[model samples]
Target: MSLRTRLTLLFTAIVSILLALFCGLLYGVAEQYRLREFHARLQAEATTAGHLLLGQERISLNLYKLMDRNQLTVLPDEELIIYNAQNRLVYESGTDYLALTPETLTRIRNEGKVVWREATREIVGILFTDQQRPYIIVASAVDTYGVRTVASLAQLLGIGWCVMTGLMLIAGRFFAGRMLKPISQINQRIDTITATSLSSRLPEGSQGDELTQLARRFNRMLNRLEEAFKLQRSFVSHASHELRTPLTAITGQLEVSLLAEDEPDELRATLRSVLDDVRGLNRMTNGLLELAKASMDASAVPMGPVQLDALLTQIQAKIQQLQPDYTIHLRIDPPDTHASDWQLTGSEALLRTAFFNLLDNGGKFSPDHTVWMQLIRQGTELQVTIHNTGVPIAPDQLPTIFSPFLRGRNANGHTGHGLGLALTERIIQLHQGQIRVDSSAEAGTTFTVSLPG
Candidate 1:
């Protein structure tokens, strides 16, 4: 069954069991009340018959007839039998439906009063004493009318149970639908959303129930997916333009040379121009590859612990090999610390690529070809700062410079694809680290990387 049907059925079943018990209890109480009232009427009739038998001067047949017709009349269908102290039948009244036996008489004498049932009839036996003479009065009557009344009540109760159960089932289904209406609306809205229509959202109710929380979480997930799609589209568009420019240059240069039949010197210069375009193309392609790798998992990149001070020394040595005349000053704050505390968990190659990009940017931008590299420990985190005495980046351009192919206005004459800082950010994010940049006229530009030690 559907969830709505199941919920309705469950509620109906619970109410059904409770109503059944209530009906049984009501019937029992009603039956007990009717039986008690019947016994009381019998006792009253016995008292009246005892007075009639003893008040006479002589026990005659007319006296018996007078008592039978007038004295013993009480409730409908009532039968009366009177026995003397010797246990002999003295007078009888009403119908002789029940006969008194010796055993029955003995019990009534001992108990004074007794009540019992025979088939469909109720019997009450009472002992009456007047002037020390004892008499036994046995009375019986069929509660036919009372029985019919109880049966009618039972039939009414059965009908009421069925009617109420059906009503409860209908009410349960209606309320369950009202409660889950939001979920149906959400499902419909979600069905209409596709990759191109991620802007659509589920409607949320004001109530802070589970459904509200679910809508909020789904909206958050949609926001993330939309952002990722936009970023991917931007990267692909920029990459296409960047790749096309170099290929166009190389193709044009080769076409002109082929048409000129080429003087050796002119052909050599055309080849040189084409060679330069090919090298730039190679560099841009390699930068794009590095950017892709930075976004990958640590397992794909082969991770290990990298020591900070040692890594910095190695970068300095490598930069010296490329630019022997360049100089960078290195500093460490409060140097007394454990060696293990300086270690970071990550891919050595990826970390080295990120550091190289920062250093290259620092040197390329610095007027004096000099930069400052600082290593510092703060609690359980290690920080590396590269401060270059370069022209400060414009405040507005600082935000977008880390985006792919987006160079600062100050980078007008720079010879590099703008993928460096963006790649560095992706690598740091992959390792659960943070990178931030501060730039000003007084401070020049500073790039700080913070990683867990």
Candidate 2:
């Protein structure tokens, strides 16, 4: 069932049950009142009959019977009978509607007074004491007016119950719809949003309810998606341009070599140039793959304890092999350090690549062809600083220096695909580390990395 329908039914059922209980209680009390009031009237009439017939100044049976038959004193199908202490019947109203029994007379003598019902008839028996002797008064009547009154009340209550229940059902449905109207509107608004329409935000209502908070969070998610899309587009554009350069150079050199005179010396030089371009292309492709690996979930990356000092020393040898003209200096703060102090948990290959990028960039940018590397232990953190006494990067470019394929003006002479710094940042982030750079003419440029030890 629909939510609205269920709500309506539940609302109606609760109110109906409460209303039914009230009606039942009211009907029961009304029936009791009717019985009590009618029984009191019968008892009153019976007493009056005893006073007139069994008193010292007793009147004739005919005169008393005549007075008893009057409209005011008589009831519908009423019967009155009196008996002396001897259990003999003295007077009867001549209605013959009720038969006086010996057991009933004995009960009246023993109990003093009693009231009972027979079908629609109500009977009352009382022991009447006169100066002469004790007498018994028995009266029976069918309370036709009172019965009709109570029956009319029951009919009214039943009709009222039906009418009230139906009204409640209608009211329940109307209110339930009102309560759910906002959710319906929200669903409709959500349906209209698509990937292309990510900029379109949800309208937060003034109520400040849970639904409003939900809309606000969803809008924030859309903002992030839009930013990621823009970044991806820029990345693809730069990568295509960078790839086209080397491919074009290789193609041109091959075409020229194929057309030139087949001299061994010329052919070998052209083939060597093409091979260099191919190697550069391969290096860029590997860097792109490493960048992708670094951007994945940290939990998915292989991890183990790596000693920072040993890893940096290994990278130092590799960098020297690649560029024999560059000089790197390694420094450890508080020079005597324990092995455990230099250890941190991370992917060794990724960490190696990240530090290699920083050292290479420093040496490549420095006019003196030298890079300074320092590892300092700070509490549970390991801090590494790579400094170069080269031309400083422009102040404006520092903010986006780590962006993919972004090259600084100082990078004009450097042959690189610009994925190094971006890849390094991602790898550091995967290891729960922070990397930041400071550049100036006085300090040249320095990149700082901090990782948990």
Candidate 3:
């Protein structure tokens, strides 16, 4: 069932149980009070009649006169009896009277008090002494007065319960609907927000409640989704452009080879060019695949403790071999004995790839300038900073420099697939590290990588 219906049912059931318990308690107390009142009145009447008989009053004549004056008649279903001092029946008052059972008589004689039973309806029997003589008086009726009082009370209580139950049900429904209205609105808004309309947001409510918080959180989620979608679109577009360029070059070279007539030298040169283009294409595709895989499954590629100084030394040696013309400087701080090996947790291959990419970018952009590589330990973190005197990047483009296939305007017409920094950033992120660029028009650019040591 819906939440509102369940809430209503729950409320109704709780109220019903409480009301039933209350009514039961009230009935019990009221029944006790009524019985006490009836007993007290019977005792008073018995005492008054006994006093008059002991004062030499005509007790039988007085009772008969009272009955006549009050127009009281002995009902066929009622009983009236009187006994004298000798325990002999002195007067009888009803047509269908049944004699008291021996057990009842014995009880009355021993108790010397009034007694009654359900079988006798409203009958009350009293024992009295007149001049040291014992007598019994019995009276019976339908108990119309008690019956009317109990019936009225029950009727009033029943009506009050009905009215209260109806009011509670109505109030319950209203409150449930009011409380759930925000959720319903949020659901509707969410339903209307498709991929095409991801920019849309739920209308904020006036109350600063949990529903409002939920809407805000949902909007933030949508914002992230929109950003991811945009990145995916850019990646696809850049991939297409990068792939088509090399394929076109290879196709052109192949066409020339097919059209040429026995010029082996020219054909060989064209085929070599084609092979170079194929190799470049292959490298770009592999880089893109690595980046995509790392983005999707970083957890699958577990990281272990990697020595930072050793890794950097290795990268510097490799860079020297690859680009002998460029000067590369390595600055490593003295290892601290207290330090835990200056090691970080990461996939060795990916970390090496990121290092190589940074070195290559430095070498490619600053062929005439010295590149500075620094490794320093600060607290529990390792910092790797690469500074190169390359062309200045615009402030606006700085934020997106590490994005996939994004090349700065000052790349100097260099041939690159632009996945280098993107892959570097991905690898750093996988290691729970951060990479940032600080650049100036005259000071060149510095890329700093911070990793947990």
Candidate 4:
């Protein structure tokens, strides 16, 4: 059933149960009150009959006449009988009177008081003296109109209960709808959002309830999805551009070598150029593959504690072999001491590739300039900052510099596939770390990496 109908039914049931209990209690109390009132009226009539006989000094015929005159108005269902001490019937009232049984009469006479029975209806028999030699035994059936009165009151109360229960149900439905309206609206808005249109949001009402908070949370989720889509688009575009450059170069060099057939020297030179292009293509292809692997691996791979100073020293030695003209400076704060006790907790080969990429970029961009590498520890975090005295990157360009296939404006036709920083970023993120660039036109650029201890 719908929520409104269910709530209404529940309210009706609760009210009905309460009303039934209240009516039952009231019926019991009203029945008792009616019985007490009936008894009081009967006792008053019996007392009056007793007084009339005591004053007359004989079996007064006037007592029966007096009772008959008052019977219809005062006690309609009552019967009067008088018997002498000898147990003989003396005076009687009402035409249909059935005399008390011999056993009942004997009991009343011996007891010398009033007695009652409730067999077919109600019967009461009383005995009294008449100021003469004989006594009186007056037997009467008690009034029973009180039973009808109780039934009528119960019927009236039952009607009132039904009316109150209906009102309660109506009130319950109204409040239930009012309280649930926000949730209903939220559901409708959610229904509007599908795979085709994820931008739709729940309408915010004037009430600052939980529904508003829920809408805000859903909007945040949509925002994250949009960011992921943008990232994916950038990755595809950059990958295509990076791959096409090497393939085009390889194809052009091979075509030129194929066309030159007469001169051996020219042919050998052209074939060597083709060979260089092939090697460059091979290197770019391998870098792209590494970038793709880094992006795809969601699980944190196992890692051993890497000595940062030793790694840097080894990288510097390698760079020196490749480019003997450039000066490389490695500055380690508290030199020879480990900055962090925590392991890198990822693939060491990938980490080395990331660091090598950064170093290569710095060296390739600044041929004759100094490259500075610094490692420092600050409050449970380790930072590695690499500074290169190359051409400065613009503030607008710095943001996209880490994107794949993105090259600085100052690259000046230099050769690069540009997946270097992008791979670095993905690897850092996998380790729960962050990388950022700080640059100035005069001060060159610094790439800082921070990792938690």
Top candidate, metric TM-score:
3
Q: For candidate 3, report its TM-score.
A: 0.75
- Tens digits of per-residue lDDT, candidate 2, 1-453, equal 999999999999999999999999999999999889988998998898887788778899999888878868589999999989999889899988888789988998999999989899999999999985889998999999988998898899999999999999999999999988877887888898887776777787888888788878887988898888878989999989989999999999988877877789888988999999999999999988999999999999989989889999999999999999999999988788787889999989999999999999999899888999999988889999999999899999999999999999999978998899999999999999999999999978999999999
Give candidate 2 misplaced runs (Cα > 4 Å).
1-192, 304-345, 369-383, 450-453
TM-score of model 2 vs. true structure:
0.69
Which lDDT tens digits does candidate 4 get at residues 82-147?
A: 677777866666544556667877887777665454653445556666555545546455455677
User: What is the TM-score (0 to 1) of candidate 4?
Assistant: 0.63
Sort all candidates by lDDT, best to worst.
Answer: 2, 1, 3, 4
Which candidate, 2 or 4, would have the higher TM-score against the true structure? 2
In the range 1-453, model 1's lDDT, one tens digit per residue, is 877788888888998899989998998988898889877877777777677666555466576666556644446677778889899887777477887789999999999899999898898888888788888988777877788888898899999999988899899999988877898899899999999998998887789899999999999999999989998899999999889998998998888887788789988888888998899999999999999988777667777888878888898889978987668788877677677777888878888889888987898899988989999988888899999989999999887878998889879888777899999999888888899999999989999999888
Error of 4 at 335 (Å): 3.0
Residue 40 displacement (Å), model 4: 14
User: What lDDT would each prediction earn against the true structure?
Assistant: 0.85, 0.91, 0.79, 0.73
Clash pairs (backbone) in predicted model 2: none
Lowest-lDDT window of 10 residues in candidate 4? Answer: 338-347
**Candidate 3 worst ten-residue window by lDDT:** 68-77
Whole-structure CA lDDT of model 4: 0.73
Give the Cα error of residue 394 in candidate 1, in Å.
1.6
> Model 3: per-residue lDDT, tens digit, 167-281?
8888998899998998899899889998788888887766788888888888888989989988998999989999999999899878867876857788788888899999999
Determine which window of 10 residues in candidate 1 has minimal summed lDDT.
Answer: 67-76
Q: Is candidate 1 or candidate 2 better by TM-score?
A: 1
